[model samples]
Target: MYSSLLMILGALVVGYMIPVKHPSALLTIRRLSSWMLYLILFLMGYGLAFIDNLSQNIIQLFSQSAVLVSLLLTFNLSALYFVGRYLAMPAAEPIHKKAITSLRCLKNLRCLSRC
Candidate 1:
């Protein structure tokens, strides 16, 4: 953890030192940053792959736990939305109308390919 923190601090310092006005310097930094991101992603994938290649029982347990947690989160959010709507019963109509108009405008813009 300390080493990771140090690495992050070093990256921040290096990133801060890069010039923004020079086009080639900016482009080179952007490319290098993207490569670093890809490398980090690859390392994470490699670690997860090792965990996945472990015994089937461990993998199954993790999968089941993940699904259960996701379902709980979904239900909790749905319940909260319903309760909030009920408590704010007077404001729902105006909010709903505003949301509908905004959505319609967004849809029309998409249809016209303006964005």
Candidate 2:
């Protein structure tokens, strides 16, 4: 696995160092690689379907995964809700909004992220 990964990274480094004069050929290769990836995934799925033990446990696996995912989403949303409520709660009235530097920093951060 390490050797394969090294080979792939080596290929990427070689490819990056080499400049292609005709971008059209590079575009074609990119499209071909995308299709090859889909084909590989399809074949992998098809192969896995033939495994007897996995077929038997598929339902249980799916159920466990679904429950885990739902719990994760629920907890995340609950935390988000609590955090939002805390943020929104009325605080001791400030003389002006200018008193909070954090709010202005967050606005600047938002602007930078968009850029």
Candidate 3:
């Protein structure tokens, strides 16, 4: 575990040395990284196919996934609602008025799961 943490920290230090000099190149890299991340995740799912008890646990796996999805959806909607309510209050900070931020966050999550 410590080795993995040290490796990640080293990678982070190396990553900071690379410069995003152009907006277009930065945007391209961001899009490419997102796609690559999805590819990595899809590849990871292949391990699930080889599980010894997959046939028996398929339903349990799906049920747990459904439960997790419901919990996340509930939290997202609740946050959007409360944030909207907070924005309506007179004392709300100008920063809080970045209201579409929650929607964008949800969109990013949905893209990861669906795209």
RMSD of each: 11.2, 13.4, 17.0
TM-score of each: 0.39, 0.37, 0.51
lDDT of 3 by residue, 29-86 (tens): 8898789779857866987778888889999989999999999999999999999887
lDDT of 2: 0.82
Candidate number of the best TM-score: 3
- Report how far off residue 91 is in candidate 1 (Å): 28
Residue lDDT tens for model 2, 1-115: 5986798789879979988778899999899879977996898689778878996789997999999999999999999999998877677776763444665667787645434
Number of clashes recorded per candidate = 0, 0, 0
- The whole-model lDDT of each prediction reads 0.79, 0.82, 0.80
Off by over 4 Å in 1: 18-20, 52-115
Ranking by TM-score: 3, 1, 2
Ranking by lDDT: 2, 3, 1
| Local accuracy of candidate 1 as per-residue lDDT tens digits, 29-115 | 889989998998998679767774467667786898999999999999999999998876564444543333656767687644433
Better of 2 and 3 by lDDT: 2
Candidate 1: count of backbone clashes, pairs at least 3 residues apart or interchain: 0
Candidate 3 runs further than 4 Å off: 1-21, 89-115
